[model samples]
Target: MTVKDLRIELTSRVVMAQILPFGLLILILFGLAISPDLVVVGDARRPVIEEIAPGLFWLTVLLSALMALGRAFALEADDGNLDALRMAGLDPAGVFLGKALAVTVQLVAVETVLGFGAFVVFGAPVARPGLLAATVLLATVGITLAGTLYAALAAGLRVRDTLVPLLVLPVLAPVLLGATQASRDALFADPGVPGWSWAGLLAVFSLLYLGVGMLAFGPLLEES
Candidate 1:
């Protein structure tokens, strides 16, 4: 199921044509707004944009993932594919995992592009590569698990395109927060932020949503 969904996503023009460009555009807009050249005349040695690059990077990923989430289920909801899947007697839990994993894969690719943009445009350095990698892995899992679940719930709704952000973004506050904090610590080597602890929070968030999605997806699939 995972491979099937991934193949669909990879083949879709929307994934290649829309999501990546949108993410890069967001990164460029953020760079313009923050003005990488602008620096504070205070004790802080880094420019304001550089200091907040981690948060900006994650925010870009979150917004891009919103589009990816919408696309993930939009395909299934169209052309009676949802009905076909239900009739095929596939395990709902397997379907859920497949879809979530596909979204995660897309997000990881999105993050890599944006990460490079942040590196060059914001001059953000990776002081601790290990912590940054851990944060990215955990946060991506959490975002996709919760997002795929919410996408399933909103699947059959006409307003799902607009409704998904309303439903999932709020629930992802912890992920955005924890990811930003951990990424900042990893990038800057901040002594006070406890990067690993925030990564731990991301792990817990991912696991919590993983169980919820597995148990609830079957019912949601039927209703949608």
Candidate 2:
């Protein structure tokens, strides 16, 4: 498929599968932020928002990532749309890119909502907005590629519904650790040497998964 055409098709499905949950995750985070215990307990340390919020933020992001992965191909598989896409000459790489792009957009949306909520509920400083934004982008892109690839592997299988999370989470251990820690520093903690270092790791992850997904997706998506 041409890049433009593939992107359009990918965007349509991604919005359906990825965006809604991302939106909900932020709302959930917002609710959690108001929890007197969560915010108040961390209150004394004068902790940054990351220390205060990264736990919740990462939890929501993790769940939302799984949700996106779970739905990645099932919707298409159910309607026999998967077959149509391949038969229509959709490039496997294009398909992966399009889907990842959509998920990335959703991730960004979640970050936006979370950003607003963080300020409103926690009164977190918006200092280093650029760094914070970069952290969000890194987190979202990593989730998108990792989840998309795993989703491709599990598509149309009975085990897929449960297996996506099981498979993706273990593989994403490093990402979760690095992204969470890095984000915490940028958002809440002092952002020591480890903070900047973690940020670099997040970038490496984005590139790693982007490459892996692009190469592996074509094979994985072929009708078995």
Candidate 3:
């Protein structure tokens, strides 16, 4: 079942959905590189990289995730194959993991690509490679774990677009704030303790969401 889910995600639709964010991030980064610095800077009146880059990186990541959510369940629904999977002996946890796996791949790919793009465009360097990687990974999990479940809940709803954001944003705000701030601190080497704290929060969110989603997915899908 895991292998089957892997196959579906590796195919074109989900892969493209994953990669589209790279393109969008590139465009945004390019715009920022060339734009007229409308976003003001911190004290000392200097246009600090730390002040602006994190928000730009995070918003791009969020938008890209939003774009992919709509496409996440379509592959299963369009072919009438999700019903078949339910009928099979696949465990509920297996099903959630499969879906989460696909979304996680998509999330990580988008983040990696955009991270590199941010590096190139903003020249944000990692002061501590290990910490930076850990922060990136935790941020990805926080996004993907919650995202997978909401994607499931809003799967067939006509108002999914509206509802998913409503469901995810309030839930995601803390993650976003923590992730953006932590990534900045870890990469730039300031307030490292707070950064680790945010990373810990992100980790907790990921594990909690993963366990809850794994436990609830079968029942959620049964509604469909």
In terms of lDDT, the best-performing candidate is 1
What is the full ranking by TM-score, best candidate first?
1, 3, 2
Ranking of all predicted structures according to lDDT, beginning with the best and ending with the worst: 1, 3, 2
RMSD of each: 2.7, 3.7, 3.6
lDDT of candidate 2 vs native?
Answer: 0.69
Clash pairs for candidate 3: none
Task: Give per-residue CA lDDT, model 2, range 104-184, as digits (tens).
Answer: 665666667665655555555544555667777787788888888988888888888888888888877777888777766
Candidate 1 residues lying further than 4 Å off, grouped into runs, are: 36-44, 190-193
Cα deviation of 204 in candidate 3 (Å)?
A: 0.5
Candidate 3 residues 1-224, lDDT tens each?
A: 67865786766464565457555655465546755352232222225666667777777777677656666776677677777777885887887787777777777777777787677666666766676788778877778778878878887767887888888878888888888878878877654356788889889988999899888887888853
Better of 1 and 2 by lDDT: 1
What lDDT would each prediction earn against the true structure? 0.86, 0.69, 0.73
lDDT for 81 in candidate 3 is: 70
**Candidate 1 residue-wise lDDT, 1-224, digit = tens:** 86777676666646657898899898888877766363222223475654578888899999999999888888888788889989999899999999999889889988988898777777666788999999999999999999999988889779998899999999999999999989988987766668899999999999999999999998999862
The worst-scoring run of ten residues by lDDT in candidate 3 lies at 38-47
In Å, residue 128's CA in model 2 sits off its true spot by 2.3
The parts of candidate 3 lying over 4 Å away from their true place are 13-47
